[model samples]
Target: MAPIQFQVGEKYFTANTKTLTEGSAWFKSLFSGSDKLVLKEDGTIFIDRDGDLFAIVLRYLRSQKVPVFYNKIYGHNHLLYDQLLTEARFYQISYLVYYLENRFYAGYVASVKVEILGLDHGVDVPLPDRDDDTDVQYYPQWCRKEVYVCPRRVAVHRGNPGGCGRECRAAQGDRPLEYEDEWVLKTTEIRTQTILKHNMDSVKP
Candidate 1:
């Protein structure tokens, strides 16, 4: 896959940087079952004392096994904040864009309280492929709430403009915006320098 090259203006950090192995290992154990990696008062990171910001980006660019799952009750802001580096590392995106997309998709990102470091951090991206619903079954239970159902026959809204007009009329004629090209992946490179600066500062202090 040549590691999916991102657009030039798109943000990306090198992944071959160094890490404080002992610190990272200790950090991982300290926050078991959670992905919140942070720095201690003395500036030692939980994951790596000398972790490379670029390398973390590469980890995400290479794998999808990591997902920042948080307690829905306690809220997921801290979880998301902590994993900003991780997400930027693996997904080849800026932390800002990553958080913004997740926020819009989840529909409640505004309430979460954490600072997304850059000025242009969370701009909205327009919904893409607004007219497709062929993958409705792939959606979560919350997404099925307003779906239109047809009882007389077995017709599902395929979201194609002319794909199922007659079939829907014969079975279930009603329609709702059932689905679109859900943006599970996107690029975010603008905040790379800022993050890199954070890494440098951590090392100095």
Candidate 2:
């Protein structure tokens, strides 16, 4: 058939049925069974999306590789990144989700650190070394003790990306990600207090 026209914002991009169906199941359903698509007199479908960002998505669709613009976007444009994510989900493109998550994780890990509670001390899980270490976040002396990390097991069980919440498994020791640290300690402390309170009541009587 003819090239399917998409009007993103004030601009337009063209795609064919084959390319749309190959990348997105949502598109597959939309094109195959929907009469709701508003087609121009020239038979082009008008899609309401940000043309600039949708252009990036289309590039990824055409070429399996993410555009080099991703490098410029990393660590700089959280807003655009989030917008792109919204667009990706709207289109039901799994590859876009995977690419964004993985790419974002690189910047995320550099700026965030995960800490595990130890019996006598806190074990700091260092992030991957980067050439430019300026943006890597370090814990303040006071906040160091307050920062507790979620283990991979718990995050994965909760459907966090990479089976570890925040893609933090690289820092954990060889243990299941669910192994609780600070939160578990707090719960245990509360439970112990309750038991102690009961014992004290019995003794007082």
59-178 per-residue lDDT for model 2 (tens digits): 767765543222321434656767887887888888777666555323323233233332322444445344332223332232122323355335334423344433566656586444
Model 2 residue 65 CA deviation (Å) reads 1.2
In candidate 1, what are the lDDT values of residues 44-82, reduced to their tens digit? 333332234334434433442233323434434554545
Model 1: what TM-score?
A: 0.20
Q: Candidate 2: give its CA RMSD in angstroms.
A: 24.3
Score residue 29 of candidate 1 by CA lDDT: 47
* lDDT of every predicted structure (CA atoms): 0.34, 0.54
* Global CA lDDT computed for model 2: 0.54
Candidate 1's C-alpha lDDT? 0.34
Cα TM-score per model: 0.20, 0.45
Which residue pairs collide, candidate 2? 153-177, 153-178
Q: What local lDDT score does residue 24 receive in model 1, on the 0 to 100 scale?
A: 41
